[model samples]
Target: MRYAGIAWTDAGYRVEVLDGAGRRVVEPSSWGAAQVSELIAWLVELAQEHPLAAVLDSTNGLLDGPMTAAGLAVCRADPWLLPPRPRFGSVPAHRLAEQALRTPGELARVTAEGGTLTGRAEEYFEGVRRSEPIQAALTAAGRCFEHGRRDTPQVALTFDDGPDPVYTRRILETLDRYGVRATFFCVGHHVAALPDEVRRIVAAGHEVGNHSWSHPFLPDLTPDQLREQIDRTGEAVARVTGEAPTWFRPPYGALTPEVLATLEGHPTTMTMWDVDSRDWSRPGPERIAATVLESAGPGSVVLLHEGAGDRGQTVRALPTIIEGLLERGLEPVTVGELSAAPSDRTESSRQPAPAERP
Candidate 1:
């Protein structure tokens, strides 16, 4: 059987084509996606000359389309290319440190060496390091597409600063009644305070995102600190819900270039709202609903808050907001579903959810 491997590097992608005996048929070097596709096609033709089963590294999901199009059976490489297992358990923060400590071992070496960890050790260690969780979340997010599903216009409803023991339940109940799904951007402290609420949010078929560990302005922190904020929050959420958050929203609509760079390879998508209801300021349900309706459009991500103080306006606005979107020919979806693509619209018109009512 022949195998092909593709790796993205600082210079570009390195494509390798191997023959039946695992001998190199093509040398590896920087190649663009289109060139890589051409190379793969050539390799497949060569493989056909030998009539052998072909294996290809598809960790990035890049070859999914082309491989399937070419009638090639593509299997994802194990997190680190180790033997198959039932599941790769969570990688603890300390384990990541331990792996780093190894410095020269296979586990530590892969990450330190800087390439896509495509082997078994890489996947296992990544899970242990909480790397896989965040990456998985981000992968789920990037899969969001607009015209891929159907032509019917769909909208997503998202609420930040939530999982509040008091208000989140009410919001969930409303969502349940309407058979709608929304995304909740949760604070680490809040999730820690109300673990049950966090679980309930997940169980109710809703999506959750990281608002931050303490809701700090991302731009205010150093790159390392910003990562810490996101990591800590992801760890907390994963601890309670068995899943890491895949979406992130900077507090106060603040994000810096450093913050973006810090998040580059972490796997969570940066989510911003499109339709702002201004419900955080006690804008009244009528005004909140009206604002959302006025701004609603195809692929809109509406921002609402279930917790963060005096969310009564948002709570009251829910049915009207959903109804209004429906009235305007929009289908409310989760932020995961909304921000899946560049063309996807998100509603960010709302004020910050009120922390306290004056």
Candidate 2:
């Protein structure tokens, strides 16, 4: 899937095609917000022919409605996730921070540039369901788990869907620098591409878990594909660490009955988070830190990202998260360690259940 970094060009628009890594793909060109809907429509039709994730800058009340109309799903994305992204062309060059950079009429503009073509787009674009009914089935089967028992005062920190060459190493270094050992749930393809990082992670005495081969929504894949996703990811992790990862976190936390049944005896635990950093949205470094720190406790598993877009916000928040948690008297441990510790079982009893995707 190709991502684009777009900017407003004095009178119109400009964009630079980017790889998922936020690497430049093409020379910048004028393609302002006005063209976003058409592009979204084109992408929607194209997805029927090929798999593509539409990552866009659609701020200021633009694009998402059109995307929803074009049969493409809409999830909030943080510009921080894609650093050095194309800013609105009108933004001042002196601005050092990306989030601080903005267009002149963001909140002030109340009218849509193009009149609603809702009926036309709806004829074609259809929204996907939040999740399959299988989630409830898995919950009933007792296969879905929001977290482990919080017996002790130590909380486990698990980083997901990464092993990226840049952020992963920085996170590992931060953990090592703090003398904290956390778990990293890695993707198979990423592990293959950066096996050295995997070795470095294990060498640092941090735990590694499987996060599937392709990061697909397990319920969307056929049973065979799901099995391959689980098995292949474990193999890749084991190939580097000499032992299969003992945990599995479903991509997007979209676990289903088939998912649990497929790995019934695979020695992997289905892990989910009670607190989401929302770093992927790049709210701010301070807010990210606060979210993790505020929700942390004896058995809290804070959902933080090390990969999938730029995680610099996560990096920025790391030291604060560590320091704050420590000050609050919480120790960061791995998920495996969290489950293994005999839980008072009551530490998290009064806490609200994690709002994991069901």
Candidate 3:
């Protein structure tokens, strides 16, 4: 029997289909609205090829109506309920504990900061525990990440929107001087133009990841457009680095359904940040440093930028951020190293994604 599993993940609404061999694979979206008259029309066409059932983890199984309308069967199943999810891969246990145990004041502060992290984590993992297929889809897609460990001092420092001819080099030099490892998510166009910068980032023992092609808001693009953004970026980075990035950050962290449809089989995890430096706003280095040092703990992903602006202050603040983190007994690692399981974690420990990939 052919079946599909659907869950909204760090990506958009994630849809996985069981192929003829009963192997779960990413479902190619036929609802592109290009040639299709309606989503139901497309789903109906899909049904004619084979009998299909949908297994959903969310009580909000938002896809149920469309599936049933398309003449497909709907079944409530929790592929993530018992084993894999919330525990599988590298879960930021210490981070989740911090979130789940937020004090009233802290909760109010997070709310004021527009953070929905705690609620999202609580709901997603609860479903992951009961649904095997849903868990598989998320896991295979590299949806796992870690924050700081409860007993140890390990965190990640991630910089995005870079390969700026000047600023990136400065950041690299600083990181090298301090013998620190950080993760850089580079844009495709920038990578192509400055393969040298990308190489420099990789050569310095830092992790490199795809940050998309032109830095478009992904949700606004079609499936084909999104795929181009991802594939071409991966190709550009792979051409210079010899290995395709196993990590991805949506441009401006804008992940929506149309956006994630293109990432089905890609061998990359979605990386997110736990701490916000707000450096992109041109916040002074002092505020940036204070934000990270005060909010960071065992499993935090500190977000900063390099190419999106002058980045001089960020360069200046780099040493202070590192030193302060150290004084707090926190060890900084790359996003790849920080993720507990797939080790390609994004540590989406913070709230809403920034403008695009952060």
Candidate 4:
């Protein structure tokens, strides 16, 4: 196996390939961004002899489409996880190669397993995942709480990218059967397409949250774009439900300084989750149930998705998850009901905004 690290600056990109033994196989080379085709051709030729895993900084997400299209396995190495680089130097491309070769679990992938960060990478992402905007916004005013009050015996099961005609309705039925209320973070466009579905969520007494307009990576949007995404979704949800959302969860948990600043004074609690079910992967009903039951406890904000894909697995796991939480004497409730300070949510802790790897 070969590990190829691709790093870029405003000027261009640099590529370095190394074997398992840490010996350079492909000498370090630089390529202009426009030379992506040439770069892909070079990598394709090399891959004929050795299986190559192309590792890139999260900032170089633009290259993911081209690299993966060329049949190279693509992995992301986040700058937040790397050791501080020299002020005048970029993160060493060779270091990325070594990390990919060492504990590959630390890196997220565009293709392969391992949903949440594992091993040392987990700790690094957890420590640095909070966007600058979250910190600044919370420092000045309101709070960004991942979980509610730990002392409470309540847990919040929050769903993102939802109001789907199929899964959302099924999830609502399951919740209705269980007599439980959860939060749904919905996208704007989805709301418009399925206003009745979103209305059902509110009519059933579940909390609705703004999940951006089209669910794009929040950090990538310009300030105006960010505001529009938020406002549009908020308005759409309010239009359908006859009530504006009081909570906001950035899509993919991706937030930026601009996002926080723009949302500052928006009168919505910036809600995140402490426990990620990783149900998006549709691991299995049992696996999903166990994942939630294992980490979920008092005041836990559990992440689940009801829309944007075939969520039959998540729907299957719903009953077991609810039963397990009940058996443990923890009541599942909405984010608003679980958090004592929902109106003035305040916390400085955050997880790094993970790259949108598909």
Candidate 5:
């Protein structure tokens, strides 16, 4: 039997294979994200040559679906459990392979299960209900507003769809470097999956908002479903962060008449954005930085993302965005802080959520 470890890299992944005797079976090779299919094909061929099992760091959860779907016996090893190598920053692919070969029980087998985001959310809620008290539905929902006061010199950098094991920490480091406090509107299951990351966000003085339970289109959900989505997410976040999120941003800035009516009394502030980085679109770093820099001004809420996919470009562009905002004399603050300014500010400069999509 052979063990193969795949470590995530900005380029894609680095693969290392080891034989039963702890000798290198194959020289480490790197694969770009675009070449995942080829990587899988190579792994399949390797498996055909000898019985093989693949190990990936838990942060590389995104690769689990594809690798498992291709019939690779994939397993996840927690990076936190790896013994520290003082000078070496991150766990290397070779170390992961060595660990798998030495202690196979430490790895969790990855299977073709938990098919959809919605399914994962339901599963998470079931576990929570069994162990934790369900939180009450929010008592009142504030009017949804995009930007804060134009007269205030504060702007907000808000991330959506996160608690990602990797990118969220990277983004946090960038925010820390600049002493900036931002808001993270997290997906429910993501929060449940990585509560420690969510706690870290709060510990670092960043605000957290509810993005949704499953990131579904609110307009399509019945009133009960919508409430469950919001409530479940609220409970999941509160379970870890110690407080229910005080703000909610509908997935995709999607708010229709029925959705709004249903949320009328739900306590979370419906926060939207004025300047959109569109980082979720995976635009190049320059484009992302330019979009935020060119449009953001006083009281603008800039939309960015830390999770839901490869957010490398967003992470790369963040420093430039922070410096650019500082140069413009705008203070990057939490949404709660930014929104608390002058409620009388007009909406002329704010970007309204688009009309419900057909």
Candidate 6:
């Protein structure tokens, strides 16, 4: 009696059977559809003989619909266990080397020993793992709700790189007039420079998130630098607001393998905006407001910048954007509240239809 597993790899499917001693009893590979079918049929027969539990990897299981439908049980291993592929086109070797620096134990050992993998590859591995837990949790939570989840249209307004004394105050006033709340991704240096503004953001009940200390591209920095960027920023936010930030938005939506590793187990949700308002470019207020209104939908994280440059247009655009959302029957909410909001299926005192994902 033992356990058996099937894993899909770049090379094809691999089947491994383990005996009571946790030793491999059988190993086989199937390269073609017919071979895969025969191998799976063989595995089922072997399972009956040994009364073994089948633990096929989920990613591999999905590849063979017949195997899954045949009642084979599945477990998931890190999807990254396979060889890496370029997200789009080929990436530079040095960059890949940097990304690889984040994997632990056996994987790291193999990557280091292979000498073919780069530091970037290690970093990439680490970053993917860092955000995996949060994504898994959210997805699981979403699966729990079954009814009352109306897929209603909704939108969220988010401002980043901010807590500016002049512009933020004006933005807050507009939001207050509309009785709306927005999320602000505050840079650490900005928080330090504008403690009063940061405190006002909290006092006004807006959500605050870390946007890194000085908005550096995370992957370019070493592990120590990456840690310092996040740690110092969080500390600065705490010093000003009396509470550590629990949300993080990487600078310019950029994440590197090392950056992801450095963020592991941190009590922050990495946030990315769905819409860009071009406020930082000093676009006309009307143009900025129109862009937000046009692009926003339910579950949209509309991005605006409160600092980083003159934001007079952004200040001017706030009221119009708020008004437009209200007219379209949307409520502007902070990212935290949005995450905690009841799913479309649940009926609650504050329950509303699920907003569309931007």
The lDDT for every candidate, in the order shown, is 0.57, 0.59, 0.59, 0.73, 0.73, 0.59
TM-scores of all models? 0.53, 0.59, 0.56, 0.61, 0.59, 0.55
Candidate 1 residue spans exceeding 4 A from truth: 1-152, 339-358
The C-alpha local distance difference test score for the whole of candidate 6 amounts to: 0.59
* Superposition-based RMSD of candidate 6 using all C-alpha atoms, in angstroms: 21.1
Clashes of 4: 6
Alpha-carbon runs more than 4 Å astray in model 6 = 1-153, 341-358
Q: Candidate 2, TM-score vs. the true structure?
A: 0.59
> Whose lDDT is higher: candidate 5's or candidate 6's?
5
Give the per-residue lDDT of model 3 (tens digit) for 1-358. 4555444322223345665554544444422211212444554666677765544432221234334434455554322332233211111222212222232123211121222121244543443345445435654655734354555577789988777778899999998887899989887756776788888998888888878765554544556656666777788888998888878886545444334446554567766666879776556888888888888888788888876345787888899999988888888888766665432234444444222222
| Model 2 Cα lDDT, one tens digit per residue, 133-234 | 544444355554455566567778888867777889899889988999798988775676678988999899888988876454354455665666678778
Best by lDDT: 5
Model 1, span 1-358: residue lDDT tens: 4444444322224555555444656565445422534656765786677642223222232233334445553433323433222111112212222222232133311221122223344433433355434434543655211221335477878887766766899999989988888888997756765789999998998888888765543443566656766787798898997778877776655544445457765666676656677765565789988898887778777777776455677788888887777776777777655544333322232344222111
Candidate that beats the other on TM-score, 2 or 4, i.e. the better one: 4
lDDT-wise, the better of 2 and 5 is: 5
Cα lDDT tens digits, model 4, 1-358, are 8989877543446889999888999689987644656788898888989888888754343355446656777787765667654322246678788889887887777742332221234443443465554664583454676776777788999988777777898899999998999999987756876788888997898889888765554554456666776787788888887777878887667555556676675667687888999877667999999999999989999999876555788999999999999999999988876765533332211433122100
Q: Model 6 misses residue 313 by how many Å?
A: 0.9
- Cα lDDT of candidate 3 equals 0.59
Candidate 1, number of clashes = 29
- lDDT per residue for candidate 6 within 32-81, as digits (tens), equals 32244466677678766776544432122122223443444323223344
